[model samples]
Target chain A: MEVNDELVDKIAALAKLEFKGEEKEAIKGDMQRILNFIDKLGEVDTEGVEPLVYMTDETLKLRADEVDQEISQDEALRNAPDKDSDYFKVPKVLKK
Target chain B: MYTSFEQVKREIENGKTVEDITRNYLETIKEKESLNAFLEVFDQDAIEQAKKVDEKLKNNTAGKLAGMVIGLKDNICYKGHAVSASSKILENFESLYSATVVERLLEEDAVIIGRLNCDEFAMGSSNEHSAYGAVKNPHDQNRVPGGSSGGSAAAVAAGLCLATLGSDTGGSIRQPASFCGVVGLKPTYGRVSRWGLIAYGSSLDQIGPLTNTVEDSALILEVIAGSDQKDSTASTKKTDAYSTASKFEGKVKIAVIKETFETDGLDPEIKKNLEERIESLKEQGHTVDYVSLDILDKLVPTYYVLSNAEASSNLSRYDGMRYGYRSERAEDLESTYVKSRTEGFGTEVKRRIMLGTFVLSAGYYDAYYSKAQKVRRIIREKTDEMLRDYDFILSPTTPKTAFEFGANDNDPVSMYLEDIFTVHSNLAGTPAISIPAGFHSNGMPYGLQIMAGSFEEKKLLGFARTLTE
Candidate 1:
């Protein structure tokens, strides 16, 4: 339950959250509380029961693999927070 | 003058304009803005739909809920309307198609007046985690309307809408209904179609109605419940007329799960009210038996593990590339997927996703996910076994009425405890209805839950109506 910096960073990585200094500590406390609740699961005896994966007695049916009308590239990109004419823009990755 | 559903229907039928009814309700919603019950009121669309219904009424073709203004929880889809889930990620996205429930209701000439607010992705217990804002208890503005179906419950409580459709994953529908003093039903898993409902813990999610009376809930459930080719998971059985309860005859025996009542977390007032309701049932000549589901204690943790695991997988479909709210920066596909999900989902959602990913990860799947699934089966088997002798199961819908907003913010486990009374029905895949039994000392309503076997929604609603009466 003693949440320090390293464990916080690891959880954040797993969750894909981008956090700076103070926020990390806050999330760590938040995570600790959640973990505490999860720990309660250990108390139950689940030996013979089958875990329910989905609620339905039915299975999902697959639709025919047909092409639907395609939205124009510009239309799709219209709501993007950052985009170039041809592709979505992002921070440079491979090289400087 | 029109406090009941029958009154509304009768008055509206007698040459009243749908616009007038919707306008009157919108004014009420506006006046009660402090409750934060709605994300957006679609006044123009509602009036327009109502006018159409009025025309139908004039032509002697009025449907079941003609001109009845309904509130849709933000997560349920409505064509050409923003389906935000009260989250920033889907903030600007207008739904491309209506959910099956919405489509069915529209066909019945029910007017959708507004999109009710909810916890983001229907994730939280208190409705506090909504990106838009927390919905306050309609009965007491300072307290939360229990969530993530909080807004829908509050809307019905405040008379802002005739009835609302809310998705129950674990206890979302019934918990809030308990808090707000309305009837909320969580149908057997496949009773209502989920197509176009934004996925939230897919396996546990179901769409059901929240209304002032159990009969109205049944009427709405009949219109919206049934098999739909659009959602394969919808039951293949013909839609049984749920409102047949109006003519239902006979006294039913109900089992009150003793272990659930004895649990440490139940509030004294709630416990007291539950006992009184049981006594009332007995007084009505219905046999009341004390049933014990020795495994009742496992409901919450089992629910969280199974729901979160499925949620982690179902929600993986949302990435920057395919859906709303993509991040501006991304290194590659992996990073884009990670970053968008990380940033898009709220803290509680992230925690569940993380727990799910961890449990289903390489070494731990057997230890966590597999184990949880087994426990789930046991819960269902035990519940099904218990149902054979008892006509229904009864319990408190929530441990207490609405708590102050942020009351459990520092302690998520405390918040999760609120679902204690209602989680078992979801785990067992049974139909359950929560009806207001009485008020707490604080003057807010407390609800009693009645659960029945799969496809026994009408029976459950009938019993609930009898109890509430």
Candidate 2:
């Protein structure tokens, strides 16, 4: 039930987001109120209830593996902010 | 401007070429650009499509939705066009492929005018969270157009488009329709394909139409609802003749949740309006009754817990490697991921992502995420039990009509509560629709919501048409 900078940092890290000092404090406060609000779900008696993952009782319909359409490499890399000839260019991950 | 698809068809039959109609709507969009309802207008593409539809009509081979111009809620994809979901993360990202809804509607000869602005990543109840700007309520410029489908609904209300497609995760479609005084239908979870929609809560989201009339909503549903191999989760059910909605006959039993009207969150004017509609239904020989949902008070909490959890998972795909905005401050892959996400996403999106991550964390997973899932089961089961005897469930779409901008900016929970009545359908996986109920004392319009059993959109639209007429 405790909300603090540590919790916010942990969550932000897990979600692949970053929060600076003042924003972190503000997010902690906002998240505290939100978490407290959602905490009201703790009142329900869910003893034997199964978690409903998918809304339907319909069994998962797996499609047979096959390629119906294929786009060219040019199209695939078209939206990348930075890209090499055929690959998306990201900042260097390792030293040569 | 036409009021419904029926009118559009009639206009075509009377020699009003689809091309002319497209131009008129484009002019309206340009005229009402101040509303910020549309993020972009596909002017040339729409005209070209309209001309093709005219040729098809001349050959008497036109498909359904001929001459009907509609807008997309930014989140739905249209190949070769930009789809931002009104977030900087995906800004200027052109869809490599069209959503199933887009393909189906285009096949049926519908003209897509443009993509409308919405909440960033379809995350907020008000369109203010949009990266572009807030969409003004067509009815009142000073107030918000309810969101995350705010622009979709506003486009329909302002006659900028005949109808629009909106992705409803919680109340995105219905709440905005209520605020804009239009008919919004969120089909059963799998009734429509989610293949092209940028994911929010994968389990909760469904694409539906916001239109000026129930008939138009039904007509659009007819074209877009069907099974798809691309989206295996899309139901294999055969499409229905939803345009026959008005032909629906016989009296139906409807239940109005007692707890909804009792809640302090409800405006007294809205309470009075919905009660009067219930009375009208009774006078029409339908059995209208009040049923208690003891868990009604907890709807928002249950919805937020489950939806945000799914959002956190669904949004992990936005790593800056492949496409979308890449932060210039990145030094390495890790910083690229963190910095791009932190800089690209809005505050609301970050807040939800953080909450989602927390709830699904190791120790808290069982307590928050799993427990909310269990609570969701209760909500769905309870709704199913109610629908067994009643053909439909009814309530005011929102507690109140549209509010002035910045009213709930300081309080996030207050904004989330606007989904109080509308989230029931998303949780229950039941098809639901919001039709114009009447105006409030403040002169802003609201909608009356009607929900039916899963895969029962035919019945839901039928009942909605009867009420709308």
Candidate 3:
């Protein structure tokens, strides 16, 4: 688990983090420690066990998908940190 | 401040109006400024609700929790309130719908006192990673309130609220509750609905109560437990009579795992106290057996891989394009996603998200995520086998008592180790609770964990109630 600066950069890109100079090494150290701990999972004998993902033993009971409540456009936009008329405004997301 | 929820409820019934209760609680929260428990206090809404509850009391329509104040961990949703998981990206985002627990609590006529602080997205062991700030232990301000449900624990511990609701993924509720000297219960997975809870690890995430006593915890559990049509993942099983279950007097068959006490790096006092507690249970006619869970060593890694993978997918919905915070300047959609996420999430969150993506990505899924899941299944099966013979599995909630802020700041591995005693229950989807067993040498609270088979919360809580008494 020798996490290098290059791997740190890649991890940062994937994670969408804005890491500075020394922070990369710090994070690298953290990652190494975590990966080392995670490595211990290899020791367990997991033969023939079904991967338990969702805990509910029963299937998700579904109802006819119906609207319980409706929020007005104005109410929806109230909490937006950045907003415009009837729309949530954001940094220009489309590029040519 | 009275620690029992019954005491608080009695005072409210005697003449203290709901308004008086909320005001006194707000004042108490202000006085205990050292405990950084709350992220946002819903002052207006709480007052309004308190007044309504007061009216209900006068009209002789008070419910079980009439005029009782409750603190909500920031992760639980409350309509018209900023329910950020103590991350900046969601700092301004108000929940559009109340979480199932919130609705149920309101129906019980409980007052929503405020939102307690938490680790970002309920991720960290200590509340230090919260953007708002870390919550200090009410017992000792220097130490952390164990997290990611630190605030809820602190609020209850400090008597700012009668009880609080928190979401537990690995051990968020129980660990913090232990650290803060409260009763924290994690119901069987799907015992409580997760409809409005912002998903952490959807499969493992469960909403439970943090209260001063196991009885209060059960009271809150009764209101919020059972199947919900809103959350498909919620169990369809009938909610049991928790209050009645709490009164069961029996010498419980308790199994204290040998490996759990034998774990390296435990505080000596915690071990002594746990042993003494086990002896006490035995003296009360309960059989205390030493069980060995050899798979205990694999808990930490399996938890991280499974939790991070599920988290990566669960959090993908938070992209600024759909809701919450957006960066001021984004050149394109990719950068918009990048900058918003970069600005919105904290360091720990980014680290987990990246690690999750890495593990689940092409060429790595089977080796990492899938392998972790397989190991998780083994842990579950082994645990089920153990529970067949024992009514409960007991352990120290944490290896050591509450540590000072920054005690493990430099070592992430050390921080992850705090979850060692608590992660197994989540992996097995069992009901677990942490009650105050004793105190550490440092004068901080120590927690004793009791876990039972899935859907055995009544039995587990019954045992916990006896021990706590």
Candidate 4:
């Protein structure tokens, strides 16, 4: 399938990324190649085959809900580029 | 240079302190700083830890890796230390808590010297994608130290550290280990906990060790491998005596994947080296035969589709909001997400995220993402079938030795193909190792990959030890 500019734009939008005119085109070319490469899986006979979501057959072992381990509020906000009073402050989510 | 942890301990037994060893490694790391192996060397912290270990040694309370210094792959978390998967998005971000592996290693008295550079978000075949700079091959300056564990392999190869912990998702550990001419092990998918590893492809990602010797790899795996309460996927099975266990005891059956030899673009010298190694094995009374794997070509495609899909989802958490890099251009919420991501992530990372988004997009999910999962099951079943018939399924760890810096820069597919041989183990969820086979005529070393059945690290390491011998 052709990986066109519109498709790249759509995916980039979904991915929460922006690209310049040339950057989008360059990525478009790359996605085309990658898509064509992955499209080879179309030849596989996956009939009667279950999708291998997890690597092993073992079911997820549920641990008891308890306070096991946690970092302090100070530690949680330690690396934030912008924060205030134990809150990680981002750009205002709702318009002013 | 102290080649092995055993030798490091031997010197300690001869009255040398662990502090001396740490100082010596620090000196070597300083001398070889041009290779760009270590992103940061925890000199003071390592020295403090080493001094404490010396006190432990004096009191006969030392642990398994008392004097062994190791490097983290920048992706593994170490409490209060920077662990940025070599991406600008999370540059200078300190981990709130240590990864389960780091905690285990520190408990065993291993000195974590520093974090090593790698492909941004562990996404490239060559180390060039690292935000800091490309790590040069210690053997040949112009060539790459293969990635995404490039700095880990280079660190061990250059004796910057005795060993390093690297995560393998589609050959991140093994391929770099092969390129750097060191022993790189990718234990069974659940063998080691991924509790604190920065996830790329969650299902395919596994943490393992890159070391100078197979025994060293085995030793490191012993300390770090086991189930963790934090990681539900961590194996519940009992950990094996990987370092002290009996090695391969008899002549073994080996299966050579026939398609590896026939695969186009395999370096001729690498093919010849593989043949000679097989011949040598046969001469030593081991049974070796070719095995059919019609799905050889499908491995890379399935890996890319599934891994990128997972990565796109996994990496979405890195917005301008919480920690790490935030773009100055952001004024509101949506731009905060878009501009920060576009600026923070490198080109290759963005390319992958975009590709991942395309595949998992509404219109094409079945043809790509869902179909790749079914194909993955086929790959796993076929690989397991082969392992049941033979003690080990062997192949070359890479298509060729490490290439020049800009060789495959433009063609991402060519770079993706570098992982063709090594992705098999991750796809199958089996334990595999890259043992340095020998050097090619170009004076670059190649590796032999030996894969064994799932959760059979005891036998896998034994076979690797025998093969290395």
Give each prediction's DockQ, rounded to 2 decimals.
0.44, 0.87, 0.64, 0.86
**Native contacts recovered by model 3:** 0.71
Q: Better model by DockQ, 1 or 2?
A: 2
Which runs of model 3 end up more than 4 angstroms from their true locations?
Answer: A9-11, A17-20, A67-69, A93-96
lDDT (C-alpha) at residue B434 in model 2: 92
Top model number, DockQ: 2
Evaluated against the true structure, the overall lDDT of model 4 is: 0.91
Ordered by DockQ, highest first, the candidates read: 2, 4, 3, 1
Which candidate, 3 or 4, has the higher TM-score?
Answer: 4
Scoring the B chain of model 2 against the true B chain gives a TM-score of 0.99
- Per candidate, native contacts kept equal 0.52, 0.89, 0.71, 0.93
Question: What TM-score should be assigned to candidate 2?
Answer: 0.98
Query: Which 10-residue span in candidate 1 chain B carries the lowest summed lDDT?
Result: B321-330
3 versus 4: better DockQ goes to: 4
Candidate 3 lDDT score relative to the true structure = 0.85
lDDT of 2 by residue, A1-96 (tens): 989888887888899999998899889888989988998988999999999887777787888999765678999999999998978889999857
Each candidate structure's TM-score, on Cα atoms with residue i matched to residue i, is: 0.93, 0.98, 0.96, 0.99
Interface RMSD of 1: 3.2
Q: Which portions of model 2 show Cα errors greater than 4 Å?
A: none
Per-residue lDDT tens digits of candidate 1, residues B136-202?
8978889999999999999999888888999998889999999999889999989999998989777
What docking grade applies to model 2?
high
Clashing pairs in 3: none
Q: What value does the lDDT take at residue A31 in candidate 4? A: 87
RMSD of each: 2.6, 1.1, 1.8, 1.0
